[model samples]
Target: MQVNTSNDVKIYNLSAGRSQPAWISERKRRQMERADVNLRRRIQLIQDFEMPEVSQGIKVSPDGQYVMASGAYKPRMRCYDTAEMSMKFERCTDSEIVRFLILSEDYSKMICLQNDRYVEFHAQYGKYYRIRIPRFGRDMVYQPELCHLNLVGASNEVYRLNLEEGKFMESLQSSFATEINSCDINPLHQLLMTGSSNGYVEAWDPRSGKSEGVISCDIPDLISNGSGLSVTKLKFRDALNLAVGTSTGHILLYDIRSPKPYYIKDHNYSLPIKAIEFILEGDLIASMDSKILKLWERETGKPVTSIEPGTDLNDLCIVPDSGLIFMANEAPKILSYFVPSLGPAPKWCAFLDSLTEELEETAESAIYDDYKFLTADELDKLGLSDLIGTNLLRAYMHGFFVDARLYKKAKSIVEPFNYEDYRSHKIKEKLQAEQSESRVKVDKLPKVNTALAKKFLEASTNMDGKAKKKARMVDGNPLEDARFGDLFKNPAFEIDPTTEEYRLINPLVSKIEKRRKAKESHAEEEDVEKGEKEEPTELPDLEENGRRGEQEGSSDSSDDDREWVAERRKVHRTIRDEEYMERQTRRARKLLMVDPNRRGKVTEVETGTVPLISGRGVNKANVKPLGARLDEEEKQRGGAEEVQLAGGNRQMTFSLQSKGYERGREASAKHAMERKSVHRSSRGIGTKIKKPWKGKK
Candidate 1:
């Protein structure tokens, strides 16, 4: 998904085992003479095969018998037989090829991805079939056990298709935040690993179709510095180790056992890495633009060497058995490099000492700069007799050694020291430190006692002897005066006449005021003697009142009437009678349970009077019954003894209709009101005439 913006990316058609040109051969020969002897002896320019079309991918068959090459601008996938080192057959596709792979255990057929949308399987006999995908696929991997080719699309969606049937079976949603750029399958672990353009590498379980782990490849500094790196290529060394190439030309090798990458290699050109692979167990090889190839040792993560193969390349592949590196480039040719078999040499070395020596002969000449024989007497004089045959002396002389054991003796300022010496040294250091501190000058400021400070400064000044003598002369004066003798006679202060203390009072009244008071008192007595007329009071039932008056003997005197007026006023100022009526009704309703025949006959008194005790005056005879028909009561009882209801003290209200049965009666009435139309026969035979009514005169 990452475009090569630094330079135009061109593909080439590649062929292997082809002879190189004369100029190329001469160049290789000249370089060999200058190369180190070990490299010169083992490395050789094997062959180069040139074609017309640009190659997009180059891969060796699983059996290693054929080398297949496909081009981005060409329709044919060419295969070269390793035995003959010549083109065997060409399977042509409808679209230009982008990548090609040989299906495992099916060498007779090969799969080609063209234009990122068409996937074609080409047979050896030149017949092929292709499945057109909906979107552009960035990378793909074949799962042998599942018989599905997992393709990663530009939108980060992964599609799994049955390779034989070429039908989409399932799609695993993207596990990354960006488009997938590269993908690989770990056959041993059965895990699918995908790399994205945003530097995320995620591992997925194909069987469960779930993401297992994820790793971000972008280094913090690179992204922070605005040089975000994208994953350009991914190669799995095995089930446990993975090699990743980034757009920033960084090679990262990750081990499944750890969260971080185990090895990393950075490049100077900052070109996108085209391919990455584990060539020989521990050595890694990576390729970039301008045919730049680099080799690194896995143990040290150090580059062994780098070379430019005289042209820009598209991709790289390695033949494991032959130790040959094949590169597809823009020159319409595949370049091959035969790696030297020599062990790595020191990077800075010539042919003379390119390889390190196995062992060294340790003798007097090799140990010391100059050799000399020392006598036992001379050794004793120099204090060297004790170390004459020991390795300590030998190591001190030799600048370099292969089989010498070296150690450093503990260093000390004093040859030997005891506890007393240590204590004395410490005391000396402390005294020195104290003396140094004492020599330092510190500024001091004057101090004042704030607590004793006076709240106010006195204005007094010291008096001279002359001022003190003058102060004694003005002591006592004014012995007496005429006004001072008369001060008591004239009242010390005159009281204001408006004050109550100076006011005069008299109780006598004049004749006019006394006459006015007598007339007013006389008028008040006359008004009391002539009182206003009173209104007459009438009872609700005059006949009943008359009968009660006869039985109770008209006991309504002025005192009793006044008492009733006061009691009525007191009752009006208190809580209303309605407050206790409901409670009293509930209590009296309980009395109705004692007489079953008293149900529905309860009535309330108008005056809210209830007789607490039988025959008491509290049961006033003037009270009127509420909510009961007097005529109906008269008919029921035949004017006999008044059968008062058991719960008759409660106030009542009346309505014409029954409340609890209204809904049922209305529903029944609605049903009875329903009528159906009946058609009468048009013939007169079905009609009957009505007869006239006879007068009852």
Candidate 2:
């Protein structure tokens, strides 16, 4: 039985009315408010979504991962993945139709039987285990009282199946001469009951496969009514009443301990009753026709409830404790009677009322506490007493009001306030963002040179015609032999160059230069404003030296402190030459082209692609000394400048910007790899049984 304990409501039960708190001081009011706030924060606990199938012959997996339903045209059992929004794993039977489903006691095996009297077994995890139907078979049950797994097959001949071996323990003849139509195992009595097509019932010994009691289900009064004698469905309830629905229309309640019927009721419908069900833990029997399902008491055989089965519905199941009856039909109708007082209260109803009460209180206080407006009749029409809460406000906004002006005015008054509050929040956010941008700008302020303008002017003039001519060498192209041909030039030739041409990195050099100039110009303006006199002793910032000394010297060293500056220059040159020599050797080895090849020698190499001098991978200045210099190579060795990697595949090429690129001959290779698993056969994953991590089997 599915008892829903979580939904038992805690209201006053209509016997007790709300009373005032013992003390109504302002302090007590604060405490109540805190408690109410806490209550609202907790997620409400309730039995939520009902299972989709009001499943008959429901077999839930012992591992609790699946639920199999047996009913409908061809019995269909759906397996499910038991996680949130659990999904169907697979259907049990391949037939696309099933009459009934019986789970073997082991649960590891499931039996799907069509009405032809043959049963098929699908092992829980293995498909190897299956059972063959015995001849002259009736009905079979795997478990009784819906309890443990025990196999029993009975007919004119009865047999107890030994499930472990897919065979029967023994076979025997029953006292009845008819094939069995249905069977029920009474857990309370520990006896297997069999009902035959010829209106006979018998109890069989489970172990020996012998008929223990011989009984007949015929009624003299029903015979007088001239209905054909056939038992439709039978169920043993509580070791007492045997509820049987017949093929005609009569339902008989028989006391299994006696031969006489305890009660009998004939259904009004001429059509045969299809199935019978007993609401577990409740003294009720339900019978269904094609159009309706009827419930009656087992002992009195009097009607308890009736519902239209929506047309075409022929079967149903009463939920364990929910009292909800799910009928199977075109759309699978699930219904619960609206009698809240009968059992667990509807969970949603309580929360709805509580929330609505709070909203109405707020709406009501907004009036009398300020200016009253709502009429009593209008308030009622608005479902203020209905406790609709914010839903009512939502519905009001959704209503089809025809007057455009009225809607516009209402929106202007109400929605605009909410929108304005939101926008003000956004404005504050924008101001915060601007403040962050200003802080970053301030931190990036460059150190200023006091005499930057004078230094710049002097430097510009020093570049006279000769200097200009040298600089002009780079005028048309800063990158001629440099390969770039000229970088950082104005891109007025292209629109949306960023989108069209690929850029590897941001133009940091240009940005840095711009920052330097801006700082210098600003410093000059600051000095002019302060009226500072230019001192003659203000020396030039060693502009003539370029950054050569700056690059090599200790940044803090004064010229006077560098007593061996001349020696250091020689030291730097020697280090550079040593690095150059090492780089050359390494390149020759990597290229595997130590001897001249058809590709030509290093000396004849074009300037655009200077073969890299390897060894220590340093710049041209460092590697020049490592290889034969231009001066020593004219005649003795016959200059060879071209250098390539060992494989002779990689060609060393560089741009003026020193951008390196890896080139490939083709996008598709000459040979493609076959689609085979990457793992070696020894990956060591298997299905071997082992001791579990937590000491679990």
Candidate 3:
């Protein structure tokens, strides 16, 4: 009888109830100093329109309090506030939504697309501004100072409208030859960058109405090497260098001065990549496909971090002020930032950021190598995984994912499960999915089309960039992107005005953890729990094969000839000696494929077909052919289509066959094992020998 025993004696807390690190980047001193920093922000489940399908359009008020949500089947634009689930106005008299819903700089007016491509900029207070532009509406954008709504589409043109007269002021021409996909006006400069279906990225000074430069596909000109890749999005890293995303899931970094782009990033394996955002000052770029949000070092072209932002990410945008980010998904769940007190923000984050310029600059010069993340073993010992989900081990494999924004988001997402004793087995499916370590690395991936990138970025957040008059407003423009002041004072969530209950609270899934008082009580409870006997359900032991599959007594004879025992021993010895004498051309047998001439299948061969073989074995396999077909013996067969040869006697015993001794001896021994049999006597023992199947003639 065998005894079942296990030496396993370790405990792990893979639950949300477990304690997180005090702060990811050593915030002990800072937190201690600012006790009031503990307040967390969350969504309040604002107005949810019955638009169960999808929202094709969205326009938020300048204050971010009122929103206009529309879709293909949706009736008009449903307007409401984030502080309540109640909605008021439905601008029902409208058309299909192809372009975005543009709210005026003051949030008092909105412009929308009609079925026939006519636009109506309706004022929230009184009047409506209408315009008839000749083009398919691809995108609609606006500027405050110009008081003009730029409509981009089949034809590239900017229609200037006078607010007071409600009439066209001037018509400006654009340089695109083909249909324009999308366009954006720079907040700092009047320069506009647009993409087209012909793989062309054209930039223009919208004020001067001239082209800055254009990037054309050089490959499409060649007949044989033509690639049908088209430009998807284009954005400016600066005035000279623009980032372009192509349909091939590649990012081309182009400088207007050079004819060719400097580099291309094809990292997502052509998975229809979604978006890329420079964070922590542009040092890091966050790009997302359907499943993961990957962080890449913009300069080094290496993946720095990643996260599973809960759903299919439709958009990604960074809030440099609070380090908060909004990952717009199909469901539109907002994401928050949780910066480590010590880690650096992205490279571009420094140059492009409004706050933490000092830290961003220092972070640039500082070296970031020696730091290490906590391993699964240590996390288990510290009892942290249980609270965060054992999936954390898998989630964190791409290095620590928290990019300053992660903390705030994670704090909200993880808080509901706090103090709960959840089993790691329950969320296993989700972990295996979103948090698996088998994630392929993206050295450098192309950017998404800037138009799509901007749409997503804008849709994800309420960051409205309107250059207003400098006055008492904080940061000069109160509603634009936040400055350093907001990070310390403003939290993300606004308490719902209606219920006043915690709408952000997640539904409870697991049981609460038991509180312990003394060590004695814990031991007694463990003993009591152990005493409650129950048979564990049967499960297949998959790991058993690794230890037990090896057979101990199997004979090592040739697979075809088990009966010829004597010949097997002699051949094994000869082959072993011959292998050492043979000189190999290269080391390691070239992994799974090998050829003496060092070539792999240049031409594909059909599977399951019987290949023609000669006495030389495979054409490439036979490194040293055994030489010479017996033409004399073949002629003796009377030139038949096929000849049969018998090998019963190699020698009728005559000398002088010049080194034929070995073959003769082998032939003799082969005949002996063919008919060996055994029978048992009175003592009762039985033995029998099997023969190698009749040898080839």
Q: Considering every candidate listed, which one attains the maximal lDDT?
A: 1
Top-TM-score structure, candidate number: 1
**TM-score per candidate, chains pooled:** 0.42, 0.38, 0.39
Q: What is the C-alpha RMSD of each candidate to the true structure, in Å?
A: 43.5, 32.6, 30.1
* Candidate 1 structure quality by residue, lDDT tens digits, 1-697: 0011112221111122212223234766566446634323331222234455577778877777777887644466777776655677666667777666788533587777777498877776765677777778767788888788987757676788886675787677765646887889988978888888888888888888888888988787544348577887888877788888888767787897677887777776678788776766445554454458776677786666565655677878777544455788776656654343422221211221221122111211212122233445544544455675664343222221112222111112222455787999999999997575444222221123111111101100122346545644222111122332333224434334443223221111223345556776888787876565444575478888889987674454444456556655554444345447868999888855553223244443353333334455653422434223344444554423333445754334222334557888988777766642344566876456666789997
Output the lDDT of residue 88, model 3: 63
- Report, for every candidate in turn, its global Cα lDDT versus the true structure: 0.58, 0.48, 0.48
Ranking by lDDT: 1, 2, 3
* Higher-ranked by TM-score: 1 or 2: 1
Give one digit per residue, the lDDT tens place, for model 2 in 642-697.
34656544444221211122223232232223224343574455656575588657
Query: What value does the lDDT take at residue 94 in candidate 3?
Result: 53
Candidate 2 TM-score over all chains jointly: 0.38
Worst 10 residues of 2 by lDDT: 361-370
* Ten-residue region with minimum lDDT total, candidate 1: 451-460
Off-target runs (Cα >4 Å) in candidate 1 are 1-48, 104-107, 164-166, 224-227, 281-291, 342-697
lDDT score, candidate 1, position 352: 16
Residue 543 of model 2: what lDDT? 73
